[model samples]
Target: MSQPVAPKKLRVRGMILTGGVAAITIVGTRRSNITQKKEVIQDAHYEVDMISTLETRRAGLMQARQQWERKAKALQERIDGNKLRTIPGIGGTNGATDGSASSGK
Candidate 1:
């Protein structure tokens, strides 16, 4: 009967070294990929926060602008009212009466 032969020591050592190198390479690649993904997530979060802050500032500015526009409109209306009151036969009876009294004199 033929006996089974064991593998040579040099071939066994070479195979172990190759397997160890392959494992280290795979682990290193995975760690690099995980780090890149974390960075991407952080960047996305920062962008979202920036956008939120800008939107809040814009909304506040718009509200302030609306208030200023309202105040300006009210002021313009008051000015127009004063102008009408000063003009003859436009808003006040005092102007008509004074004009008639002056014409009669």
Candidate 2:
């Protein structure tokens, strides 16, 4: 009887796995760096965009106050608007502005 042919070795599988792990490692490192840069603001979990928006809102509040004062007797009823500066943990409004941290132990 003729000898059976030997099974071929699938060596390409190892190379493929190595390539995939390298790609994942590069991508994960890049993503981690980007995420870390985003979280270095003064406020707790406040991104750069959030701080910019807060600045804009403060400017708007100043303009609103000016307008409100200009029309003192315009028959306006007393109403409390959410100034957003008082909301806890909302739009960079952390409960403790005294530099206290609440991060991982």
Candidate 3:
């Protein structure tokens, strides 16, 4: 029993470490990259850069959540609320383009 428990504990600990690293890398590293990508040489430039950064962050977070929901759905196919939540473009009923508008339209 002890021998079997040791391997299970080790695997669980390893999974936790992997999840932590993935979370940090996905959010932290992408945030840093966005910071490096934006250049604010003028007032309008700063506003545009900041707005774009915010939008990117929003979209990234939404995508992450939707991915999580997809995984949840996969693991438990009968989760009720998510079935109605509509993840959009990734196996959910609604597409992401449903309410989007073009800049000049």
Q: What is the lDDT of candidate 1?
A: 0.86
Q: Over the stretch 1-105, how does candidate 1's per-residue lDDT look in tens digits? A: 233334466678889999999999999999999999999999999999999999999999999999999999999999989876655565546457455546554
Q: Each candidate's lDDT (Cα)?
A: 0.86, 0.68, 0.80
Clashing residue pairs in candidate 1 are none
Tens-digit lDDT track for model 3 on 16-71?
99999999999998998777666334666888999999999999999999999999
RMSD of 3: 35.5
Q: After superposition, how far is residue 100 of candidate 2 from its true place, in Å?
A: 76
lDDT tens digits by residue: candidate 2, 1-105: 233332223356667888999999999999998887776644455666788899999999999998888676343322234342365444454555555657657
- Clashes in each model (backbone N, CA, C under 3 Å)? 0, 0, 0
* Consecutive 10-residue window with the lowest summed lDDT within model 2: 1-10
Poorest stretch of ten by lDDT in candidate 3: 88-97
Off by over 4 Å in 1: 1-7, 87-105
TM-score of each: 0.68, 0.32, 0.36
Residue 30 deviation, candidate 2, in Å? Answer: 0.6
